[model samples]
Target chain A: MKFVLALVALVALAFVPSFAGPYPLGLGIGVLGYGVLATAWAMFSGPTRYISLATVAFFGLGAYTVAVLSETLPYPVVLFVAAVIGLVVALIVGLATLRLAGIYFVIFTFGLTELVRQLVTYYEVNVTRTLGRYVFLPLGPEHIYWQLLALLAATLGMAYWVRQSRIGLALRVIGDDPVVASHLGIRITRTKLTLFSISCVIMTLAGAIQAPRWTYIEPSIVFNPTTSFLVVIMALLGGPNRLFGPLLGAVPLFLLFEWLSANFPNHYSIILGLLFIAIVFVLPNGVLAAGESLWTRLSRREART
Target chain B: MTTISRRTVLQGMGVSALATALSGLPVLAQDRTAIRIGYAISKTGPNAAGAGISTTPNYLLWVDDVNKAGGITLSKLGVTLPIEVTEYDDRSTAEETVRAIERLATQDNVDLILPTWGTGANLASGPTFDRFGYPQLAGTAVTDMAPDLVKRWKHSFWMLGGGHDYAEALVALLVKQRDAGTINNKVAIASVADGFGIDLSKAATPAFTEAGFELVYDKTYPLGTSDFAPVISEVAGLGVDTFVAFSYPPDTFALTQQSVVANFSPKVFYLGVGTAFPIYPGIAGPNHNGVMGIGGIDPDSEALAAYFERHTALNGQAPDNWASAVTYASLEILAQAIERVGDIDREAISAEISSGEFDTIIGKVKLVDNQLRSLWTVGQWQDGKFVGLAHTERAGAREPVVPKPAWVPAA
Candidate 1:
């Protein structure tokens, strides 16, 4: 059933390039790009850990990897390489902070993201253009969409594997109770760092994909707080613990945002904000979680009868 | 057992169903009478302040005035008809802006579309409009890559001069002064790091070098820079007489204020679009007494002045910047095209816009051989106002205020 659903989604998205107009296609590309980031974000930020807003740091790193690599190869190849590079860097980042508790890891990621943005801005402004010798290349929007799609698929697939694997159970145990897991010899620090690095790798791929989509990128887009907020909302909307939850959140929310903006003409935020606040308040586990649990309970009642 | 909650659920469903049904109700522009126009502008986030001040207010006034005068003269139909503008706020984001524009173009089926101010928002909407083949006349976006975009999207026309156009104008103004030998100007430089400024600075280098000006000090700082004391001190020490900065509102204001505070004021300060905006002069005040700017054409512009005056009188506000004039001119040109094409038809409007020349409030409007030929040129700030100063007589800024009313210095 899962494979069938995943296959259907892939087929729909594959042809999306041909059928969707630039406007719709551009929005699809954006949602998928962010969806991948949010899904990777969910790798650590599920209700288990409560790691809020850490995805942006990893996302920014991923974006920068593409910008740095795009000069040598095509953007799509640069993105693939960016995913690998992200994994490597994430390994390093995760190793350093995985020992820490909730707030420390969160703060670590925040500080690192801001630091990366500042460094990139300084390098681009002072060194890259000024030197005239070290110019950074920019990409067009269509090239960006394809790259984003590739990254989205890779990140989603990786998340699915983690969902069904032993490592996934270990991460869940760490998320549930790191103190208990430490006693059981789970090497809590090692496990966290590995997960953090993996998350960062996926984020990097998303960023690598986006560089060409907007034609121009700066620190703001890659490491934006707004992006962090959207990813959180996406993950939560999709039911953070569930696989493909971010996709559910990102696509529907983005498509709805576009549809509302187009039809109602800019009266989206008030509605979206209200909807978010209401849902979070009333549906504690989110749409996917609450709906799935209800279905499960009803099926159990029928089985007993 | 819980019929009340069940009833409430049904009620909520009923409300949502009603809302959806009402939403689908034809928001389409009704045919006949007022020619429908659409404007998508950023009105919410970071860039919203730019639009609220610059673009939207001007649009309201332009539409009102055209309505007050009965309507635009429909040349083909030979009857003046009212113009309607279906307005949407893009919420100051690229994603939102593009969505708004698509709705306006597709559903509202507006006779014309005008996108608001900023590089990011405009760039996002460019391909969308190009695909739809709507002749989007962008008023305030400084998209340097527009000439290439124009190839794919022929219907699109940019009212404001290109970034390079502005660059050459600044360089030309400095050259004219240098040739005349009043100002000790020998350098063309800037303090903007964003794409707008960097691209302009890069393009203008060859022109400045060709014109024999010394390339003294060109620097770009990050956006939201605090104290530009170091860059300023360096440029002042280098004796870089003309400080050229291409920036948006805040950065432009910051650079100017820092220059003033640091007391490193150059002799002939030139800027990109920021200098032309009315907001900048107010922010800089008398400190902006002797600056030059690269800007679009505004008629000796009683039509626009009246547009501004009426806007001020009605809303207790002045037109935000020269963008008001450009957006107003764009709609005026578009209306002339539609009316010339006669009945509501897309191809006819395109053909008319491509091969039509009609008089507008902003002098004569013509898309000669498919290029928007309503001319544009640079202007200088003479006593706080951006007075049209270059090739005005030839470009038609000449009149009773002939050669620009004494207070305006010759460029």
Candidate 2:
């Protein structure tokens, strides 16, 4: 854990310079963003086992909310405004879909995202044009990097705090056996609702952070299905069930994408796809989870001997 | 994929498009033994229709004309090297495009790289070529942000005008019309939500204001939209006379088709870019008889007709305004750059584009302050043809072609 903390701190420090150069900085910022999103997703899916798929709904709503509100205030204030909007959106979405399980949850969330995207694109709103013309924020280099860092930490910090809390215990119990948890006097529905809302807020914040990076908000990129898939894949491939999983997952995957895109062009997708398939079959418990278990077992055997 | 009749195709291509297709093959390499160039374009996908119509045909004609005139002289090798083109299909995705460029620069290692079709595809591949420092000559992509985008990523350059050209030219065309007493009404703008669409959509304010027309309706939708009923109905409700369509092929087809079905005929319908397709008129039937646009090379011009005749025979399709002319002109600029630089080293060629004078089909073209110097003109659809309607001196026809003043009950 100390090693991981030190590594993360060093990487975060190194990331400030990424904002200085265009190519390196852009890729760095993007990878960091996905890392944050993947981390949030891992907590919900790893222990909760609900397969929450409304990441898009939360992200898109948050993005538009920030863009529309920031027209009149600073991005920080706009983010708070978006959190309020996201809370309402999540409440409606959660109350309707949180009861469903497994595949049902996935499909419902998918449809919800598409609906949100369509509404954003077609529906006309009566909001003032305070954002004026530019949809992007104007910030200096240090400010953007600091904002991004703080946003990332806030998302991670909240997710970690929830995972360690009593509600997290209830979620774990619900994942293992919902009926038993109910028999044990745990209010599963209320717990799931609370978790869903929190999960959505975290995802919304991720979108808020992302909007400034592109400086343009469109229903497509915000509600992008690809983003949902990336987060899920990162979490699952890293150690899914662990706190360090998503960060670990995003590193190798993004590296693979960048390297192949730069060097082999044609073989980029082929290599990434093959690697993903290999990982899925061979590393059932993911890289960190399985590797850690193997090391612990080896040390235990040596102690016994 | 049925064979397009040469005569029928020629009837449309006439002179401008044909000459555009044939006119700009590289003057045999002055120092090297051979000139090898690469083209990265989509050979298959939803947008492939435009690629097939525009870039691919003109490429075949340009290469064929040069090869027929004997092998290209290569200055670097101190001998002329017959032109050899290696074409790769990007599958119309940004990731695929990036990968394709990497292969072109490192493996097949062609001297010149032709621009891919769409903005997103180019955006994906643009950074990779910049990383390796290659001279990329894009034939058809229109985004103002693209120049700044490439400058940030570093090396790749563009030849054909970007999206700013389309919107600015429409404003120029409308301003001319308003001054000439050709139109007296509100302006409506319809753009999509793709790469350059959002930018162009927002561009209506300046353009409409410059032309002195009140912007009545400014609407944007997603790219794959197959129907324009709801939007066109809204535009009709606004009672607009001049409509600016900032759309690509698929949505272009939809908007034009639906506008006709809705009976919402703006007096001067400005289909800025997408309707530049020759197939558009054939697709829209009589509805396309007098639509206005910004495709300078007329389909009926003599030079363009020969291009259609030859291109139809070879590539099995008719040449459209956006697809063939822009792509051909890009290659023309690229070949000329190579000739002037006298070497295949990527740095010198890129510097030449980044630094000097270039005259191509679009006339006296060059990269000024990382944007275009000229090329914001207009074209109009007359009798099922997209004719050059502005920036004359090349087929030289500039004017609007719908709802003549005689037809309007004198406002």
Angstrom error at residue A126, model 1: 4.0
Model 2, range B1-411, lDDT digits (tens) per residue? 111332332233244334322322333534434577776677755557767777777888889877887755546556655688877766564434554565566555567677677554555455556667876656565556655666564566654565556676667767767777767658887776554566566565676776567988876666687888888888888876688777777777777777767777778876655677757766776677677765656544565576667777877766776546656656666666676776677788778777777665545666765445445357777765667776522333645665622122211
Error of 2 at A139 (Å): 11
Error of 1 at A130 (Å): 10
Candidate 2 reaches a DockQ of 0.04
Question: Model 1, DockQ value?
Answer: 0.24
Runs in model 2 with CA error above 4 Å? A1-36, A56-100, A115-165, A187-222, A233-239, A242-305, B1-116, B119-139, B143-224, B230-244, B259-267, B299-314, B345-347, B362-370, B392-399, B404-411
- A224-252, model 1: which lDDT tens digit per residue? 76677778777777777888777777766
Candidate 2 C-alpha lDDT tens digits along A1-305: 96599568956665666434433444455566677777777767777677666677787787778767777888678888788888888888878877788899988887888888767665522222111122445653345455556666666676677778998888899989988999999998888888777767777876776554444454544676666776777777787677777778776666555544444545645765775675676555666876676679779999999
In candidate 1, what are the lDDT values of residues B1-411, reduced to their tens digit?
A: 333443443355346545533543445646567778787776667777767766777677767877887887767666777877787767665555665676666556676777777665665566667657777677766655666656756766666555666666556766767777645645747656665666677778778888888888766776677666777787878876666776656767777777777776566776666677766667776666556666634545677677667768865767644566666777776766776666666667776766777676566766544444344456666655676655422442421111122112212
